[model samples]
Target: MAELAHIIPASTNGPRATEGADLTESERADPTNILVLCPTCHTMIDKGYSQYPAGELRRWKERSRRARAVAFGTPQFTSRAEARAAVEPLLGANRTVFQLYGPLDDVFDDTRADQWGRHVVDTVIPNNRTLLQLLQSNRDLLTDGEKATVDIFAIHMKQLEERHLEGNWTPGSMRFPDAMNVILKGDG
Candidate 1:
């Protein structure tokens, strides 16, 4: 199920805080884009959140190849724990997009963002396209809302697939921009 504000962007800085600061198109969008994800569906959309049209996913692959220069592991969320710490306690009455096998609390690990990242990718990639096909072929069988969800998920899955094809993988890292902003005790 979609967790409210769970798949959020990587920043908390309001616009004025970063005024005139250099930012990539991606970084600026990080904090705002984080979406609530279900345990089963989180795996697929780990790389990025913006689900683009088909033509873009294909084009991005070509661009990514050129941008990739050295051997680098996938980026792990440096701020995973901090983000979770901040978000979890406040999720007292957030919405869920889908069903879970157990308590939501049981499905998460606040300290380890890497595992969380993987789970997101795994949930969205498999059968994403296949599901689209099923929906298209059986449109008559679906309610209007079901059909809409199918359409949205299909876009997300396709975007993730493109990122995958373009080698948009990351390994564990201590200081990624998208990581949680942990304020260690006694530091401030």
Candidate 2:
């Protein structure tokens, strides 16, 4: 599992103990000053602060960010067909998972709930995130109505993630938008 480690320790007496007297609260809390490391690496860094200084940790963080951006950055397309091609696989995966394990009016049970939670984390959430990024990147191809639908879908995505990840069940969370079915298709 990954854990967030501060490049500069949050407290003066934290791992890499130093009085960050010159840094503002926001700077200390900034995402740039954080590193997502495995438990082993986190412990190694914390215990060997002299060997891995703040500047070195910041370099590692920047390298990680750049690598992720290169690997997963959203691609912009000039046409709807290209956008659809990019998004279709993720949509189909999400749909198949939902059909197989999603809550139903009278079919939900403990087993189905367990399957649903697993699929939501393993498949649905990632697909939703990628779908949203693709749609947002290809927004130029969408009509005003389609754009509105995308806006609602974004809100629905957030609520869904919050419900699963943070255990914050929000009543009346928006349902998935039907228009998403034809988002990058000519019909939309």
Candidate 3:
């Protein structure tokens, strides 16, 4: 079942809870401050299994709204800077993900190798795919130089993906960091 979850918890009894005082009950119940989640997700957030702060929840809401607007033929005409404001946070996160990459020798156990391989196959590849989709959809909004840089980055990502599938930890593993460096430094 679907449930409406609060971005900020309702208990006005902690130091941080004081921030909610600025909002009246109606404002606190604003649709923008709520998310429709499945029962499991609702319970996870409410029980602190997933600690989503107010700011992060708000960003998710804004991204969802923008995505819906775009899908519905009502895309917002935001400036490059404004568009970057929303996207840079996501691209910045890509840099951090790369920090987890290391040499293949670290995975000595077969189980650990499987786990690491799954992470590359499942998480990293899909995440990059989403980033690529976002870039492709907004290609017209980007500068020519930005487009060229992302195009090259996409090619690099594709090559890395092939290496990931092979599950070898030699040169392909070494090249992963370099590709990420180019992406982190390159225009998105």
Clashing pairs in 3: none
lDDT of 3 by residue, 7-76 (tens): 7655555323454667666776688768877899777766762465667677877887888875874345
Residue-wise C-alpha lDDT for candidate 2, range 1-188, written one tens digit per residue: 89998887777677655735566668878987789999999999999888998878878876676567538897766678878888888888988988988888887599988999999988999999998887887798888998898899999899989989889986887878888877778755
TM-score of 2: 0.61
1 or 3, greater by lDDT: 3
All candidates' TM-scores? 0.26, 0.61, 0.43
**lDDT digits (tens) for residues 77-139 of candidate 1:** 224343233333322111121122112445564534444344434553443443344345445
- TM-score for predicted model 3 compared with the true structure: 0.43
Give the whole-model CA lDDT for all candidates, comma-separated.
0.38, 0.83, 0.61
Q: Sort by TM-score, best first: what order?
A: 2, 3, 1
In angstroms, give how far residue 110 of model 2 lies from its true place: 0.7
What candidate 1 gets wrong by more than 4 Å, as runs, is 1-111, 120-123, 164-188
Give me the candidate number with maximum lDDT.
2
